[model samples]
Target chain A: MYTESNEKKLDEIISHYPVKRSAILPALYIAQDEHGHVTDDDIRYLAKRLDMRVNEVEEVVTFYSMYSRKPIGKYKLQVCRTLSCMLQGAEQITEHISHKLGCEIGGTTPDGKFTLQEVECLGYCDLAPCLQVNFDYHEKISTESVDQLIDSLK
Target chain B: MTKVLTSRFDLKGEACDIDVYLKTGGYQALAKSLKELKPEQVLDEVKKSALRGRGGAGFPTGMKWSFVPKESKRPKYVVCNADESEPGTGKDRDLMRYDPHQLIEGMVIAAYCLNAKDNYIYIRGEYWYIKEILEKAIAQAYERGYLGKNVLGSGFECNLYVHPGAGAYICGEETALLESLEGKRGHPRLKPPFPAVVGLYGGPTVVNNVETLAAVPWIIINGGEAYKALGTEKSGGTKMFTVSGHVARPGNYEVPMGYPLMKLINEDCGGIPGGRKLKAVIPGGSSVPIITAEESEKVNMDYESVGTVGSMLGSGGVIVMDETTDIFETTRNVTHFYKHESCGWCTPCREGTRWLYKVFERMHRYEGRPGDVELLDDLADKILGKSFCPLGDAAAMPVQSAIKKFREDFDRRIKHTLVQINKAAD
Candidate 1:
């Protein structure tokens, strides 16, 4: 399942590091981009390409929060519930999204349109009550405007 | 008063791009170091500058660099820690977004000083855009002869690469950063073999913060003493404080060390919103102990001054709280953050943060018993010094300090709940 173009990107990433094992994280990112999420086959392919054990590759994948072992929704709404964001009413924003989507914090919507998660600081405290749909940030969002944000996502 | 690091942040033209950076005197310090100064001379200048680490600890940057052995058969490395995952810290992300080349130039100078030809920047996964910006800047630097083989024709060759992390807050730790860079799970290794001795494939390595490294170019250009003169004796140069929560103008402001904490909040940050009364302040990131508004007024934004007031100037993140802010809810939110971020490597941290959060949740839900506050303090006390890393203590200190400074507020919540229960029974 490792395409030729994916292989080229892996090679370019590996070129930067002195050891091939150091390329595992970047290679996994590329593999995840190619596939929806990291699969067993992707791990096997990465282990073979990087000359690492399958367990080593899987260990790295499982440890990180961002890498999804299972498929995620189209739009991942990662609401920052850290201290700074919390002060700016991030909890209400999170609760509103959860109630509106009819899914739990970590659950995806029935239509598979969005996956709502309460993530740690996204490092944008100035614009508190921020959440990221994929990597795009929506800052200083209110519970009132959250409906518009969800509607506009499509 | 002087803003060196962020002066170019809002400059006309493409501020982040390479051409604008070079045009506005980028890489001049690197050129100067390679042409005029020897590697030892550069190190000496940094040592004289007294610039502490901008990353949480405030360790002397020059001393950290000096720890790297002069001779090592193994390949040496310079790792720029762009993994700014701390709760109230976003200044590094700003630097990476607006001035990526400054970080590269800083790393290049550090590598030349340490004789390290290879460097990797371990950036957070969420900062994908920042990484891309850094990569673009690196490409431009290579094309411009500021980076890559025989940089500036000085025969001081160095290569810099941006390595993206996979969403682990622990990777921000230097040892954990090295482990993650080696493509392993981010677990903090023991410190006896600190990165300076055996690091990054068994070689001497120097791990500096984004702001710390970015400050190097200015320090070198302006001369060490000139940079040192900006701040207090031990804490040199201006620090970029990320002011957030309740502040009218919540953003990053680079001010000299020893700047009055209250003055920073009132003047630079436009004071608290709605002209509300100040209650508490988290002088540093959320990890440090909380300080009262009265205590904050007496303190200055420096390592020693903040410490003298019984809290640290950790990461220079000033999280202000107003009178309208509920102490119980704020403490609960903070405890929840630490509980979520615990790496699970340490038992006290893993278990203690969870327990603390549960107790806070109970208190939040009006299930607070008489001894709940004492229980909170007891749990925090147990976790403070028992953990392997600073995170456990980070979670504990804010809880402990909140109880110390705002016990009356939490007590009022518990007393009010009792009154409601009595009234219902009657």
Candidate 2:
């Protein structure tokens, strides 16, 4: 079910740890990257691969906010809503993005092009009102800049 | 002004590149330690430096390293807690992104002291770009023979790897970090079998913060006394504070410990933008107590001085708030963060944070009852020291202190709700 390069990559990751079970996080990342999100089958497959119970793997997936069980939009717009960002007008930025996308905080667009999420601190509080499109950071963002960003992405 | 940890931040991204790092005296400490110093001697130097961990809890770094058993048969491990998830903190992100080799050299020196062969940097998953930069730097370190088998022809083997954590703030805690490293839920384990004695695949391990470990290379090069002389006696060495919110220049500033808090915000950060009055400051991250502007005037940027103002110098986040900010709304926002980040290991934290947020939400919407403020206080009191982990205390401290220092904000919501109820009765 894995590509040859991906499978080789997983093996290389597994080699970094002393025990095979310790590679579950990296392994899950690989699975999520291959498939848009991790599915039940992927969890079961990983369980067998890492010698862990299916529930164990499932628990790890659910525990972390990064791992998405369901498929996500092409661009995940995770706006930082913690104190620093909020102090710097993150609420307005979030509101503007939501209005522009025609989606709520947790919902995806009809076109499946974007998903809006109000994430806690992104550790870029120095650049208040920052966000991430997928894994890339957009720092010191403004409403107009967010409009430009969405337009550019579209 | 002492730029111990962040001297290379001005290099304009060249510090991440190894050639620049080496030219700027990056791995000199590792070379010096490998050639001349014994493992015990290295530990003694760190002890003399009086360096404290920059990761929220201000434990001494050398004391933490001494906890690992010297003769344990199990393979020793050195793990760097790069999971910089504390709200209002972003210093570690810059440290890793700007100077990856500095962290690498520090970890190698730590491993040498512990006689550990394998080390890992468990960075947060959202920091994937920084992780990529760190990986490239590690590859460069390997290429230069600073890492891998036979370091500097000393026959001591050291291997460093970067491990990414899926998004979980609880993983920043040492035991939880170890649990996450072991590929499980990031639930924190109990104390007594601290990670120092029993950690990382059942081996004696030493977990240090990114800033804490990054300071090691300098401590070794400049002599422990010199490093200790940079700061106050109790809290040695300079610290990196991510000063954000309402400031003209919001960025990380490296200053000696016990530097004046107001000076950091007013001078280094260029004060509040547009001459707005300062309302309050969360001197540490959001987890610490909120100090009023009156209280902030006397506070200094150190562990004890912040403690004197009923807050901690936690993670050196220094979240500044201007007069325009609504304390009620800000408190609600902080409560929501804990509510979401709580790992649900203990009932008080799990249920207590949820209850606090519900109350804060109602108060924020102006539907608060008269006793709601007291109830919020009572709920926070229940959860303060009664949880399985410090997450409970982290959630409760800010809410508790916010209520104490800024009671007017909470009372304002309650008063508005009372007026509406009286109008309905009339």
Across B1-426, the per-residue lDDT of candidate 2 in tens digits comes to: 668999999996799989999999989999999998999989999999999999989999999999998899799999999999999999999999999999999999999999999999999999999999999999999888999998989999999999999999999999999999999999999898988899999899999999999999999999899999999989998999999888999999999999999999998999998989999999889999999999999988988899997899999999999998888888899999999999999899999999999999888877788899999999999999999999999999988898898898888887455577688679
The runs of at least 3 residues in candidate 2 whose Cα sits more than 4 Å from the true structure, single-residue gaps closed, are: B415-426
Question: Each model's number of backbone clashes?
Answer: 0, 0
TM-score, prediction 2: 0.98
DockQ, per model, reads: 0.83, 0.93
Would candidate 1 be rated incorrect, acceptable, medium or high by CAPRI criteria? high
Best by lDDT: 2
**What tens digits encode model 1's per-residue C-alpha lDDT throughout B321-390?**
9999888788888898888888888899999999999888878877777788999999999999899878
Fraction of the true interface contacts (Cα pairs closer than 8 Å across chains) found in each model = 0.82, 0.94
Reference-based lDDT, each prediction: 0.89, 0.93
TM-score of 1: 0.96
Error of 1 at B342 (Å): 1.3
